[model samples]
Target chain A: MGGSSGMTITTARLLRAVTLVVLLIFLFRPETFEPMLALLVANNAPAIYNQGSLLSLTISHLAIAIAATAAAALISVGFAILVTRDFGREFLPLSRSVANIGQTFPPVAVLALAVPIVGFGTKPTLIALFLYALLPIFENALTGLTGLAPTVREAARGVGMTGFQRLLRVELPLAFPVILTGIRLAFVISLGTATIGSTVAAPTLGEVIIAGLLSSNTAFVLQGGIIVAALAVLSYDGLTALERLTARRTGRVATAV
Target chain B: MIASPRHKVLPALDKLGVFIAIGLLATLGFAPLMVFRANRIVLGETVDIAQAMPPGPMVVLLASIGVAGVAALLKTSAMMRLIASLAAIAVLAWVVGVSASFLVEGADAVARASPASGFWLLFGIFALMATDALTRMDPKPSLRIGLVLLAGLALAAFLASGIWDDLSVMREYENRAGSFAREARRHLFLAFGSLFMAALAGIPLGILCHQVRAVRGPVLSVLNIMQTVPSIALFGLLIAPLSWLSTELPILRAIGVSGIGAAPAFIALFFYSLLPVVANTVTGLAGIPANVSEAATGMGMTERQRLFSVKLPLAFPVILTGIRIVLVQNIGLATIAALIGGGGFGVFVFQGVGQTAMDLVLLGALPTVTLAFAAAVIMDALVDIMRPSGVQKGSQ
Candidate 1:
């Protein structure tokens, strides 16, 4: 049984490697799959998107999602930490409600609203992404920090650890895996959402799909959809792996809330 | 550290309340309360709250907010804080409407007036403070539900009152009243219709997975992958296969199962809704204690009878939670359905974006947010109410 499970892991890794290679080929040399795409698209013309290289579009898409998720992580984690502490404990309900209510605003609506306030293009997209990504990370971080076992906390205190020292050295490490899961969810969400940023004239892969829709070209939409989906899936898998590794190291089973 | 008589003279302040009050004051003092636009599309010049309102009422309103702020800062009882915040919010709402009317008094018929940053910030700050007070007060669940209904009705009446007729959003609504109604219905159809389909399919699939353990892992993983596909991509991907089907089979086209419009959007939303419903159903069923199942069997209950009488009743709240999640999520996602010509509130959103008309964007966004929020609140209340009484402490 152990050997079979190990074999399954090997097969999974091999499948992942093949998927990565295919994704790279599709992004950099999409024409290699053109004959097949032509069969799917009904357009005899070049099935590959020509306005911008798929590689560049993928990079910009990753950049926007990464930058927004990073900023959201910093702010949300800091705010969560603050609210969990003694001085900021009064704000917990406010924080929880804010996070919950903010999420009820759809990502597309939020992005559209941002365009009017911040004006068009990448800034609005970034702002929307940052705001939309906030709730999960904040909620998860709060859960992780506050849900710590009382005995473990007391043990840290018994070791003569100061509040700050205990939080930094003990609580955070134990909570890291859960917090990472939140960041993972946030990142994947941002990656998917950043596609819509193209509507606001942000240079992202959604530009490809929207352009395709405008011209009734299936190839463009397919190209954009494939790359975006691949990136999201791959990144999600990588993050899940990282989460598992950290959970194992910390002697805690990471659970998604 | 000793309690001192001198300390009694000055009450310890509520820090968060003070922070929110400061935010309100700063917004009123600095930010523009409204914008006066010459027409629907152009960027408008901002009008300060004081400048936009008549002096007498403006001064009175400002004074009320100041009083509220002081009440917040003084560590007053929760009841006092709640009343103060509610009063302040009422004043702010009236002030905004009056200012909109004031700003548009002599402007051309085509000209528009809309609430600006100061108005939004003030309203948000006060509402937060009110909610905070309410949370601190910890009202009964029934009271909370009643308040939500009352607030919804008040908003409907407020809109119907025509006090906001001068606002740009109201102007947009006036122009598209017929289409707005159509789109609103379509949006509801897209959200609720897809949710209905998902529940129909998902509950059965969940039962299958729970009963046949062999299928559980594969089924969940596939659903997880479906979820990972970004919504836009999923919607986009559906177009090709669906369009081909519609073209290949004229009968499907007749039934309106096309690549674009509500069909793909419905299908995509249905797919998105499946994971939560199925997962929760499986969890809910599996979570039934083994002893309970044994007792049901010992009572001479058949498998079907055991499921209906014992297991499902216990799991209903959990399943409702999943439904709540799907409902809120579908409401939000329905906005994106408009991208595929699916026709929801997103039509106004994208059009407003294209035209650079902020009010039009607000026309779409505000409703979507409100609907999602209302759904969440109602669903949450339902979940709370439906929880089996014995499991109350364990559930939370």
Candidate 2:
């Protein structure tokens, strides 16, 4: 607590800068992580960075993520809207419980169950990702749609907007930001999660990590992990930027800052 | 949106209920009853309703579905709905039992059988009906808990009745019956051990973040970033550091801290469990009103006294929630530790995946999921119970 205010250095800023530098080092020269990794791992692993092409793994990783996200977005938004509608209102608790159960049963379990019906490779991975992505996206959509400002609703109704028209013109626009936030979260989490796709013989960054683990190759593990982490961090940052823009447009509190 | 009122073909509660009932009955009448298999993993020999099992149990299941439909049409009480739902689960169990008895009794030692798509669909329909019934009833958590236990116990009793001795998953379990207990114990060890370590480290860090203005932002960001790091990658990342530590430090190796096995898995799980616990801790403390603490100060409370008396108690429920989340999540995540030879349920998961034996995988998965669900329910109930009288609305 001594001279805390007097110090010119901002700890948060300093930490962030240091973190960025470390991450950059990890990207360009993963071998540098070797000595540290070597000391920590059980085996005397030699420096061998970029075990596979990070570029390729990242592409496929993003590919799986994007596909999963797009599917999840469509289904979740539709389901949310359906459940929120008059005819479907009674299904809310059922939908909510189903979503909760999806989370309760781990995504890995979903992958296991999926493989039997779908077989190994991208299809099962996609299915698992789709299931894993549902809870967040659906919950957020419900929250956004249901948690509308009453005045906004009243205003839309007063303007002679039909139910569908009010939903499209007013409710959806207001809810878009929250929904976007959900998509963003799903995307980021899915990026990290899709690593497991490698276990099922789907091409992903996890292949490198798994390869590394099997051989006690710290450099390989670092190579795989750094990229995955970096991608997630970048995706998170990108989403935050979009979220802030949405917040500004909507005049809602900027949660992340 | 103005919903058009349709002519009443079925009563209000019975509209969806009756639909489900008819669908269930139709599927049963048309679809195969159960699948007969030579062994695990291969496509099963299909048996239609006439040959599948005795007409007795199938008839009972059919009767239950019909009754649920009729009950839905009537003005039913909570207790009535409960009975209807429980009856549905019971009948479903009996159907499964009868199918199992037929399959097991007919099969040889290596041969196995399981309920095929028709049976699974019947299960799905019944589950939906039961969910609808439960939702309508909206029983108290304790009552719901009791009902779940009762249903679970009934199912367990059926499984133990030796009627299901040849069901693929149980047969798989029987094969590894000795190792199953050991693996289960190891799984619990990993989950609890990591949780223990996480709490030991996280709480103090959370406290430090709360008390120290300088460290909060930096610490939280690091933890956040750590959280975003995927579980597998985190485990991978830990191997080298832990390996080096064990080798370089003889004393560490003496205590069995190596890079590959439980050590790295524990570290990874510990790191993953941190954010929730710490975030909750910080939130719980910050949520305490400044004026309340100021009042405590005016009343001659020391920092420790104010913290324990005001902050800690106020934060206890939230902290417990965080712990609960961590526990449930760890139970699920520990399955991955099997890949690293950490000896948890993931062992079966991987073996199943490798051998293409879905039953073996379920052997591991079902328990993990059940544990997660049980943990969540218990924690939720505990949180409700812990809430102070003024804060809690209902006296459960």
- Candidate 1 docking category? medium
lDDT of 2 by residue, A101-188 (tens): 6777777787887887788988888998888788888988898899887999999999899999988988877787888878887888
Model 2 per-residue lDDT at A255: 35
TM-score of each: 0.95, 0.89
State the TM-score, rounded to 2 decimals, of chain A in model 2: 0.83
Proportion of native contacts kept per candidate: 0.55, 0.54
lDDT of each residue in B1-396, candidate 1, tens digit only: 566978878778889867977787788778998899999898789988768889976997889889888988888888998888888877777777788888889889999999888888877887787878887887765777887898798788779888878888999999999999999999999999999999999989988988998788778877877876667767877887898899999999999899889898999999999999998888888888899999999999999999889988887888888999899999999988888899999999999999989899999999998899889878887787888677522121
Best by lDDT: 1
Classified by CAPRI criteria, candidate 2 counts as: acceptable
lDDT of 1 at B68: 87
- The C-alpha lDDT values of all candidates are 0.85, 0.77
